[model samples]
Target: MDLQQMRYVVAVAETASFTRAAERCHVVQSALSHQVARLEKELGARLFERTSRRVRLTAAGEAFLPAARQALEAAERARAEVAAASGEIRGRLTVGSIPTVTAVDLPAVLRDYRGRYPQVRISLRAGSSERLVDMVRDGTLDAAFLGVPPGFRIQGVHDRELAHGQHVAVVAPDHPLAAEHEVDLRHLAEEAFVDFADGSAARAQSDQAFAAAGLRREVAFEVSGVELMARMVRHGLGVALLPATFAAELHGLRCVPITNGPVRVERLVWSRFTPSPAASAFLALLGVGAPPTAE
Candidate 1:
């Protein structure tokens, strides 16, 4: 019924726990819950279905949440416009990235963004590309630099490509294949491979590339972290398919471009819910004058 209550509803829905939502909103749990209850009563609709282990939105809550978020975003934009007139901007700007973030020089980007808008609090999270995409889609992240597999589609989110590079093979510097400028993916098919775990963007690309080449790989070791993968390859545990940027600078490892391999592309992705002022400002730095339309 009110902005405060609507925010309470959204927080609960997002965190899925009244207590956690209260902490995030910086309010007492009882106060937050009471406001939500009052709003539900006024609307004659149950906004959330509560359980011992979780808090989920009801059908009515799901229907109202998007509108509620839009309302909040509009109000924030109005405030931001006023602040812009006064040459000041301040708020939390959460961004997500995948492990081995090769798309953007995040450190450089953050340094510049801070120099420009010191009042804005920058929150960064790193995870698998798929998980980061999910977070951006769910409004948990305002924007993200994603390293998605080649030909992967960005659905339900507005995105802009930041960088693209081909996948390359990595092995110990002394490995016989290290002397080659380019290697066919099929040549590595029978080699002991160090692979990323399934469900990851990198793993999916490797899987697809091998399938396309009509080759099967023997994954001798599985790792989900880039640092571990590089270390494994450096010690000659197994060969790996990696993004060129990721493999290029590692010590004791040699990177060879694949003759015909999956491409690794980086994209800047954001939800269509509505852009926060900080998010829009960051996009502007990336040459996007305005946020793209929702899909």
Candidate 2:
């Protein structure tokens, strides 16, 4: 019957649990449940089948879900478009990035954004690319920097290559492999290594390379950030395979090239849902969004 009710229903459908949906909508569970119940009564159709273990949408709710989502997105688009027309952009923009992502010129971009739109609040969160992509898809992040393999595709977001570079192996200067300018994949099979957690973009490259070479190194330590990995390698915890940018400022580490290694591609990904005013401004600043037309 109203936008809020539709949003309640959509959130419920997306999350499958009334409590989680309520949390996502920033409403108490009781309030959200009351609205959904009211919506069902108004429509004279049961929306969800509730059970102790899980929630399932009835036929009516399943049919209503898409329209509900589209209506919400349409409203958001209209509001954003109107705000754009007034040329007043003041809102919060939340962005996500992989830990110590060097591919994006984030500092320069944020500096320019701040200079241009000081009123816009900006928030940044760092995580793995997989987690970042999930956040963007779930409406938690407006845009994100993700490290993806070349030609990779995912639903529900627009993605483009933000930066590209090669993966390099870095070791402590005194390590046995330090003298070699280029290290073969097979050589590291027996070496102790500091590696990323599973599903990292950098790790993806190494995984494929090692699989092809029929070699697997012992991961002595796992760290979330590349900078931390560099530190670990610097301290002789283990060597690491990381983006070339990680080795840029790392003075005490030896940078060794891997023969025909996986390429590290950083991509900018944003949800296809309607973006807020600040998000539009940020996108336009990056030359991704369309320019404003003269009246």
Candidate 3:
């Protein structure tokens, strides 16, 4: 009839004495008898035989005992599972990130997350910053890594700055500028530049920097992926200005720091109310520490 009723039936069957069963159930013997009587009536069968000396199960009661016990066990297991899911972290989390973070640091972050919550499934998607932000806004992704654009607007998103790193000049190893320890904007003003797509955060920041320096540069090529831009730079197509993470990772392309002033910061962002425990757990792993906090 109900979980409590099933539990009552199980206790009565196990103990075989109304007074003892009532004690086990933490109820008075009269109340236990009334509920058991109600269940037997509901099922249209006698569940117990009573004698002055002892109590025992009827044939129907024996047949129903295992079923009632199993039902109670199943209900308890369901409750435990739901409670665990609510309080303990375990589920699939869809994460989106820009090309630079995905290529450079995300592997370590994900590996640590996997080690911590092995039951939490992680689905990672890499895209341009704009696309990843759109995915988070549209509920397609639980969280993401993004380079927050200057004056960027999002209705219900929250972000935390994860790390600060410089934008470096990446060029072919054999290129003359690659030999320079650091590059100034004035030197690259006349050279062709490999750029992130026009609307991207990196491109926007780079444009602002060039504008501040009164330097006009040509976009010799455009690619969405920072890694691709670096590879193109390696082929001597043109030079690129990308996040230091990507530059540090590109073995074939030399990364020369650009230090006119302060370097840009990268951030991890997500919806203010992401609906996944796995997402929350991963953010917790980020844990409000210094730059590149995953470790």
Candidate 4:
């Protein structure tokens, strides 16, 4: 019913434990429980089904969760807008990015943002491009940096392309192809490959390229992180195709330009709806304009 009670409920639902939720909210367990219980009594419905070992949301809780979150977000936005009107920006900015981001120096940009708006809280999450995009669409993240295959347009969100470039073949220093000045997809197809997990957006870039070339390649190892992919290539397990900028950072690898290679497009995406004041300021820092109103 009240913001404090709603906050407690949300915290408990997220953490799935009253004890942990209380710790996160910086309150004692009993006090937090009392607030939630009081809210449940006022609503005449139990939000959570508590047990000695585990806590799960009831059907009512599941139904109430989304609106509760929206309410909290609205209250936070009200506070942020007031602060902005006073020549100060104050809000939480949650950002997500793919590990292969290269269009911008993320750490340097975040450092500058922090310096400019020390009152704002910033958090970053590293994830796959597909997941990051979903987070942006769902309001879980305020903004995100994504890399997808060239010509792929992201729907249901506002996005702008930051950079577009081709991927290069990465090989161990002693690998046979490492000595080549340049290779095409046909030649690389003969070698085993270490690539992103099958069906991931990162893997799709190469998959579409090879399919278009009327060729098929063997993916010997499937890994999640780019670091692990680099390790596999360094040990001569297999070759990999990675963004040129990202490949330049990996040691013990030879980057051979591909005559015909997959092209990746890096983009920045934000919600179609109005963004938080902090997010708007971030877009300004990047020379981007405000997001358009949702259709």
Candidate 5:
């Protein structure tokens, strides 16, 4: 019914103990209990079922929990938005990125943003695109630099291709594949390969490329990051198909272009709807979320 009540309910759901939740909320156990009781009475449903050993949410509580938490979060966001509107862009801004983007692209943008808006706190999370998209959808991040995987829905988020690059075969300097100027997907079919783990944008593109070429890649090592894959390849673990730019940057990694008949394109993606102010500024600087300039 109220923000305080919603907060109390969410705390109880999270901690599962009135005393602990109250302590976290900097309120007494009695007050917390009274607030939750008041909320339950207003809703005409029991929120929690208390036992000697533990407290559990009732079916009604479980159903109401998400909405209650969201309401509380929205209220807090509104307050922060008001504070931010006072001509000071000051609040925590969380941005997610795939590893390659973080390593290769984001530093300059982040540096510039920090110089311009030093009061705004910026936090970065580097992970696979799958994880980044989930984080953005769940409000964990204000926005993200995502690689558009083929066949995924892109409706809720607005995406534009920021920079385009292609997949390439990376190998050790002394490895046999290093001598090749460019290699086809079928050449790596019989070779031991270090492939990205599932859910990675790079892996999704590579999978599609391999499938189109009617070839099966023998994945010897399934790593999560491009840097790690390049490192493993440098040590002769196996060859991997990664972003050509990322592979080229690693000193010891030799990048051999993958001629898969059709080139794989990497896209920088961001959400279109309701991106936070900090995110909007960063996207604007990157020239992806804004209108074209006159020549």
Candidate 6:
């Protein structure tokens, strides 16, 4: 039916409660319910099964939800494109990045972009490279920064290498290997290590290196954030392998270059389809050319 009715339906479906959806949509509960009921009557189908305890989508609602979201997205894009044609960029820009991003000064870049295009609403998400890549592919993220093992090519998106570097061994000041100027993977493999969660792209960087060197190391502490990993290493709990640039940011730790260490490649990735105006403007700020279209 109408866009307002579609909006109320989508909001109710997402929140699973008419009251909560009304709050989110900034309208009274009665009006929102009236709109949804009118839309349902016009369509001759019940979209939701409403019980006192919970609200769940009915069969028709399940089938209608995706199309409703697509219609809203198309309308937003149309408005944004029109604004862009008038030399005013206005849209929502969602960006994703890994916690240990070092290839670009993200905060500064975001600051500059905000200054240049104050009309655009910006949001940022921190996630693993693997998750971020998936978000970009699914259009949840307008663009993302990712880090993976060297030579690992990302599929189904357009990517550009931002930086390439090796991981260095980090140890507490009192640790045995802290004095070493350089160490190899075999030497570091003997120590307990602090690493990222298993199967993450960050963990894979080190895992592939150790497997290649015929070495296996024990990860005594597994952490999701770089700050936590650095804290664990600083407390002498275990050593860690971190990007040289990132390691330099941690105080009270010794960074020793690794002769045979894992190499990480940082990259920027976006959807293969045409980018939104906000995404295109952000990419241009990063000196990236026009995005490639899907073949």
At residue 260, give the lDDT of candidate 5: 60
lDDT, model 6: 0.92
- Measured against the true structure, the TM-scores of the candidates, in listed sequence, are 0.72, 0.69, 0.65, 0.94, 0.72, 0.91
Model 5: CA > 4 A from native? 15-34, 41-44, 49-56, 102-104, 118-141, 149-153, 172-174, 178-182, 197-200, 211-214, 220-237, 248-254, 259-264, 288-295
Off by over 4 Å in 1: 1-82, 292-295
- Give the per-residue lDDT of model 4 (tens digit) for 1-295: 7999999989999999999999999999999999999999998999999999999899999998999989998999999999999999998999999998999999999999999999999999999989998999999998999999987768888899999989999999999998999999999999999999999889999999999999999999999999989988999999999999999889889999998899999999999898889999998998889987786
Better of 1 and 3 by TM-score: 1
Better TM-score candidate (2, 4): 4
Tens digits of lDDT, candidate 6, 1-295: 8888889999999899999999999999999999999989999999999999999999999999999988888898899999999999988899999988899999999999999999999999999998898999999998999989987769988899999989999999999898888998888888999999998889999999999999999999899999988888889999999999988888889999998799999999988889999999999999988787777
Tens-digit lDDT track for model 5 on 73-132?
Answer: 577567657766886665667888876762235888889889988877899998777777
lDDT of 1 by residue, 33-145 (tens): 99998999899999899989888999999999999998886686688767766878766688898866687788898899999999788999988878888898888898888
- How high is the CA lDDT of each candidate model? 0.84, 0.82, 0.75, 0.93, 0.74, 0.92
Q: TM-score winner among the candidates?
A: 4
Who is ahead in TM-score, 1 or 2?
Answer: 1
Give the winner by lDDT. Answer: 4
Q: Candidate 5 or 6, higher TM-score?
A: 6
Q: Is candidate 1 or candidate 5 better by lDDT?
A: 1
At residue 122, give the lDDT of candidate 4.
94
Tell me the number of clashing residue pairs for each predicted model.
Answer: 0, 0, 0, 0, 1, 0
For candidate 2, report its TM-score.
Answer: 0.69
Weakest 10 consecutive residues of candidate 4 by summed lDDT:
150-159
The TM-score measured for candidate 1 stands at 0.72
Work out how many backbone clashes candidate 4 has.
Answer: 0
